[model samples]
Target: MSTPKIPILMDVDTGIDDSLALIYLLASEEAEILGISCTAGNVPARQVAANNLAWLELCGRSGIEVALGAEVPLLTPLRTTEETHGPQGIGYAELPEPRAELSPRHAAQLWIDLARERPGEITGLVTGPLTNLALAVKLEPELPQLLKRIVVMGGAFNYPGNTTPSSEWNVAVDPESAKVVFDAFSGLPANRQPIICPLDVTETVVMTPEHLARLAEAADSSPIERPSSTDSHGLRSQTSNPLVRHLVDAVRFYFEFHFDHKQGYISHMHDPFAAAVALDSSLAVLRPATVDVELAGTLTRGATIADWHGLWGREANALVAVQTNPEEFFEQLIERVGAFARTIPGI
Candidate 1:
């Protein structure tokens, strides 16, 4: 029997890693992406939407609706990581000009509408700041209860943060919104509580040079050829498969970012790991914890404080992923991505 595709809605900031996470979800057989909501983090909200639409076009999955979300945090100045994802929010790659426009509805409304339409079925995955999600919860107070699950790719529990000494980029970019989101879902029942893929687990799943080379090899083996009528401006027209070429170009910048930052030329598969866990919770070792986002601290703002030992005397409200098998994760990624590459039209 075939496995059931999990109905999902993804909220992303279109960072380099978020793009990879999008590719992972688009290629996977286990996920049925209902829509993608874009927000500001790695770049501005408009750029995030553009990147989403371009990526969907590049992957030939333009049917998925890409909706623009909050441009700034609820109570903070917007912060972006252009250095990490580069201009246009897709690293060194330049996708085809999107043939489609943004969905007519805003991301928050899409979230509310989808949750109401598919109550108790849609699994919402967030790989960016929580601005859009917080707004949706505010619009519909019972949004948390309507969704089957919420998988977040942020925080730095028991690990040093990437944005600051105490905060991950996603939460640091919008702590107030993150706080609202955490508080909203933390009150859900045990079975429906959110699952957080913090830095502790995501950092363990790194994409090495070897993996990139393997992906390129798989793409090269594909029978697809570039189309004669397609325009090649801003794209690597030399590669037979546009999707594979775009991915390689995009990851090059990410690889350099890690190398210069002393991470040994490997990119952290943060968002992709979260995407994987969203589909298959068995991909990671999870522990129940009472979690909250720190909004005010001289040196610890935006920190995800996960009380694993019940020291806070609070009931566990989230599942914190502590460990993941990198080998298995990469194997599955390679297989799914390879399968998708094979189906790409050579343009």
Candidate 2:
């Protein structure tokens, strides 16, 4: 029997890992990208869209449709943390001028239209704030029924948040939006409800040295090199480091900044892991449960609380992934990176 192709719609902010995840999806033999919608999250809304187009053009996939999504959070002011993403989200790679034209339709509408076109056949991999998804759910109540699942990379339950002590950056940036998406998915009809993969599980998935090397290999193949390392902003330092070449250096600097300042030893390839799990459940350990998002707590807003003990005896409303086979995930990620590394034009 032929392998079934998975249709995916990526909602991203074009963070470094987000770029890597997009490349993985586009190159995966089992995946057929439906489209991409850019949102304002880790980076500014304008930069996010530009970064998306840059990645597509770099990969020689200018044909993919790019939809610009929400600039600010659904019900909150926009939040940006350059400390985590560096000045530029994609490692200060001095992105080339965008070649992939932005779509005429908005991200929310694009999402709804695509969902309706292939009901129950599409998986939504969200790696940004919940603004776009929440807006889509609000506009089309029937959207939940059309998606196969929504694997989100936000919220913290057992693990401490990267932003606040209890709230992850994505969720904390827009708790109201997160609440809306969570409620919609939970309230959907039995068969229409999508799965939730909050940071409770994704936090544990980190990238290894092998993963970074693969990414570097891919970056080294970029055809367009910036004239200088200090982009227009004078942020990145010019370097002749062989390990940090072209775009790879930007990512390396970003990684080092985190390591030196926050002591974050591992790059938790968070978003892509969530996407991978949605594509292949065999990569994770999922448990059925009732996941409650805290929106009013002073310090816990955006935290995902799971009734894992069943102490409340509440009916399970979602599937929450709690663990993963790290070995399998890294292997798959490395393979995907290798394929993309080979696709760089004239490499």
Candidate 3:
């Protein structure tokens, strides 16, 4: 008998890396994307839904259920990273407006209803704030047990924060919701616990211009384009392949941002790496820990703390990614997404 395809319920903010993550999952033959839940993070929830719908239409995979979540965090005021992603959250890429309609159900209700319908079969992948999942847990207390497992891309355990000196972007966006999630998901079995892709490891998964060129080459696109720092800012890719061109344009803005911040002209593929690890946990070595969110602090609100030792006296609630082979990961990403691009109707 053929092995069953893994059901993936993805919750994303549809930022650039989140876009790549969505495409990467679509490329995987074994990943059955049950549905997508859009939330406010990189951009607003409405724009996020539009971005997702457009990408699905662009990739010729329409009709997939896309649900919109909360417009703001549970407690904190909503903040978006238009500077990091573009005004539309996809940088220079311009996709036509989607023709598909969104699911009528709210994102939180979608999550709860899916878990109830597919107990122990659905795996949650959240690459944004835990707002929707938190709200879902509040409505359905047995969510953690009903799902097979979860993979999250947030936090800054043992690593400096990207948002502030103490907090990562996603957690910083919604600490109360994160607290709600961590508290609700406590004490799950080790294998079933959330596999969190913290900044400690995700910051190491860098994507250079050469990687984009390689991705284009993998798709057999002409000219083998390489974006350069010397080029004018906002310079777009004129590659023969449309998908590669959009990817180049999107990541070119990411490269420029990193260069301006003195982190080199390399973009961190955080959400894509999280998506990959969600599909195959063997790609990285995980260390079990009792993790929590710091909700109230003089200057450390929204920081995530992981107790590697037994000081917390709590059972391990998360399996944190500590190490991964970047080369292997990029290889898989290029191979999968690039080949999938080749199969597009217009390609």
TM-score to native of every candidate shown:
0.94, 0.87, 0.98
Q: Which regions of candidate 3 deviate over 4 angstroms? A: 1-3
Worst 10 residues of 1 by lDDT: 224-233
What is the lDDT for 123 in model 2?
87
Best by TM-score: 3
lDDT of 3 by residue, 183-263 (tens): 888888888999999999999999999999999999888778888889899998887777888889899999999999999
lDDT of each: 0.86, 0.73, 0.93
User: For all candidates, what are the clash counts?
Assistant: 2, 0, 0
Candidates ranked, most accurate by TM-score first = 3, 1, 2
Better of 1 and 2 by lDDT: 1
Off by over 4 Å in 1: 221-238
lDDT of 2 by residue, 15-111 (tens): 8778767867866878888888888987887788888887777667766778899999977788887777767787657667875678999999999
Clashing pairs for predicted structure model 2, backbone only: none
